[model samples]
Target: MAEGDAGSDQRQNEEIEAMAAIYGEEWCVIDDCAKIFCIRISDDIDDPKWTLCLQVMLPNEYPGTAPPIYQLNAPWLQGQERADLSNSLEEIYIQNIGESILYLWVEKIRDVLIQKSQMTEPGPDVKKKTEEEDIECEDDLILACQPENPVKALDFDVSENRTIEIEELPPIDHGIPITDRRSTFQAHLAPVVCPKQVKMVLAKLYENKKIASATHNIYAYRIYCEDKQTFLQDCEDDGETAAGGRLLHLMEILNVKNVMVVVSRWYGGILLGPDRFKHINNCARNILVEKNYTSSPEESSKTLGKNKKCSWSDGLSENPGVSICSYVLK
Candidate 1:
């Protein structure tokens, strides 16, 4: 190897090590040989409303003659926001030519996310007024307008119904989403002690407009039945053929019980072939392990904090990051 190439490689290695230390669990090395890795960044570490995965590919000549290639994976990211983020990343590369710029690029994206969150923050007064208005509208109709303006009262009822639907969603645990070629897969996990609870969880999830819009919401559940000495188990593919069965099979292999796992896939208008199944299973497995549903030590180690290997066949790619498949449209 030439001296310059060796130096570039050394710098890249140092940068990756530093990032791993700095980000800790949020950093994931996907493919070591390809110099492919990703970092999950949130506006707030404690409680983040906006989170995105930054996948970076360092070419052999990185930091010497070539800039690191990157992709921002977030279903919410689209249109001008996506373009602007891409432009900002390019600008960082241009400004820091011949230097390891991953850290800078990450901070830049975080800054943008911070700005986004701030801009989208609802005002206290507006929120309070909306809640008050909902109650007041209902009361006024019930007291005064029961005879007249029935249509207006119906409209108000519909609005309140939507709000109730959103609030009905149970506390759900979400797995870090995996993305490739714009297609994304994320797992939603919820505790369910019975078959009725499983149905409730799925119904609540669909209440969220973004999740309801996913191309596929493959799900599986296994509830332990002490009386019968058998398990109440079921699965649904939602649209993706056989995906539900595969997800349920994974749950059974892990020996997880009283849990419902839903893997939502938002197809990016591309056929991923068999690779799609890999992502779906990975998403399911990651969440099951993270939630302490599995007892295997080896399986536990493969959660978001460790290096999650991506399969490379037919030139397909997979990148994992810390995300809940909420699909929050901005």
Candidate 2:
């Protein structure tokens, strides 16, 4: 082998050894030929059911000019979900070309799996049934829960008075953070019943130095007034151009009410152009879906389809990309 080739191979071996040390012997392995190895990643730290079994093969010019080869396996995931994740891994590799990305790939896949677990319906597996069977099951369940006397249910007696009260909305603090090409996006969601609550939440975000330093802190809020019997909506771009209005419009179309969404972006020194807007909206939409602010998961999927078509319009100007970075608050 040429001198340069020998040096490259030596460096690759060192990297492999370091990875093995860091991930432990069980999680990382090197093949006999020193050209390929496997890394096993689990969704949970202890007793994980979902896992990504990744095999990486280093090319001759790896970490200098060419990227390594990767094969991924996750039996629980299939079809478009698997394909999309594979593509995302490739994109991460391409973004960090000429550098070590095995660790990043592992972490990214773990995060994706965690998100998938949260979104999946929790229950024991049931055998597939025909439409008639489903209908019969639904009928049986309804009959079991219903009261025999429907008319007496609505009769309220003055002697035995009862009142129903609305449940208070819960506080939300978890925010999901996404990064692309050094640019960072964070989405925060909270349930707001009044306009005053919206102002307080926005104030709190701005009060934090990390959030305040962001290049843009675009926000949108929708509140339904019980006394007034009307919807109140507003948005602010925070110097992100038309981002605020777009976010507000998104909430309107999704039929989301009594919620506030804030997306903060920190400049990462690269211009993403129109893709920045896409990322911002995606960040917000993901939080909405994760928090169950929208309807059922099936309906949320359909709403996303409609969102893509209407997100871009003549309202916003096409400007050169700006630097952006962000962090999520707990």
Candidate 3:
């Protein structure tokens, strides 16, 4: 054979090897109605509070045949969807909940990809899918989640590689400084760090400082001392997301205003499971402890209290993410 023919043969071998690594050994195509092809959730998955996602595609030699697929493999899917992953795999199909979810997913992707290819008068490299769909009404469709590939795909596995459990939300702070009412609290108010009545008293000083403690996480949050009439008026309107009602309820129960506390957390990967919670509580508690809250004797203090708040930022934005919460004190 000529040198050119040998060089072409070598390139073809390299291409086949690369495809095999990605799609695995056995590859197939879709025949009839859409079915599942494969399913894959992240190896980094954790909880309902957070989850992961992924995508699958068909091999180049697709329809005349259909596309391949993939989806999440979970107990809920097996119990709820009554799915058959193997069947989808056999038919080059995909689904979401289980095996079927995988089949639909892969075929959907393949259909769209191929449809785009067949366009005779392809306009720009970046054509809107809708514009393409208007013309090429083919048999398969892209996934509902198809638009956002490279979006936040999750890896559910929590083994040493992925995210480990940190503190759950609604952190507890055992260390709160207490003193005889005479020295501070000149405003004749209650001090609470919740979604309610009290806030951090920036104006007052415990040891002649800016009434601040480096220990608190949700630093300087406060509630106003408004009565029922004003409660509905000047105070912040309640919100389900921002949790005004919860804060207000706490303030009403405490009967104080204009002070808040901070809460912080450290990720403590599954320490038998209990350790993460314990570590979070301890971390917050340590702040209070550093401020001489827990270890201080009752006789040394006029009063004692605990405050809880979470700082879950919105996963995708500047907002805090999910912070599940509950609190208890003695």
Candidate 4:
């Protein structure tokens, strides 16, 4: 190897070892050869109210000319908050262009979380609520001791209580449908910047008779929040068990933000076993790649080779080429 490559390798090793020592169990290596790793960070080490996982993939030219690609995983994070955090990371990379900056990035996120937690301190209102709950508990205990009057159970009809009407639907992109053992799976993609848009997409998709009739509609979405410097994301199984989680993991792996993907499965009364999940993920990945949410294998290799610089414009961009993934239980 050339001298520059050797130096870069050494620096990477040192940084990895140092981070492991500092973070201990929270630091984990995902792919040693590919230089991919993840670290769990929290606002407070002993008593954490909010936490997130940061995954980073170091390119070969890292610490010399390239920045380590990264992603933040936090389901509660959303909107302008995620955008602001990502932009800050890009700015840090720009400011420290030829140095190992993993520690800097970790601390920056931690600091932000701390600040957020401080702003929402538990005060008199919280104390009052706790006291009220205690009084309710005491009253319930007293009632339990008295058998003079039998307690009557109350029933409520909740079928339409939580309905959210869809006012409009965003444009959706459909991937080529997949079929196996008489089962059909087709993935739908849409751009969403908030929870409201996410709900709208689902409502609109259900308006289509074919989609509504499907056996399962596993979906996942991620939206960046600028104010909180986090992401707001969620997934639903729709009776597919762990299928929703798997779809969400695929989107995370692609580093897809401000977007949602739904895979509708029409079961053909034939048992596919593990093959069902394979077909589901395949449909999702195909649509994500087709929609440019993630790069194809050929493009990924090329991206790694180039010394991609994040300019001011890049800081404002939502996609930064960082990715992570999750698993399905069903």
Best by lDDT: 4
Across residues 175-199, which tens digit of lDDT does each residue of candidate 1 receive? 7667777787878888777554565
Return the candidate ranking by lDDT, descending: 4, 1, 2, 3
- lDDT by residue (tens digit), candidate 3, 54-133: 22443222321223333443333344222343343332321111111222333333333344346434322331223221
Every candidate's lDDT: 0.64, 0.60, 0.26, 0.65
Candidate 1 regions exceeding 4 Å error are 1-170, 296-330
lDDT of 2 by residue, 1-330 (tens): 998688667656545543553354335555748577887776565545456777788878766556677777656668888788887766655554444456566667777866766777432232332333111111211111111222221122222232212222235453556667767777777788755556555655555567768889899887755565445677889898878866775564455777899888878899988667766776777677678776532343333222221222333212222222221111
Runs of candidate 3 exceeding 4 Å displacement: 1-263, 266-272, 293-330
What TM-score fits each model? Answer: 0.40, 0.40, 0.17, 0.42
* Top candidate by TM-score: 4
RMSD of each: 19.5, 20.3, 28.9, 23.9
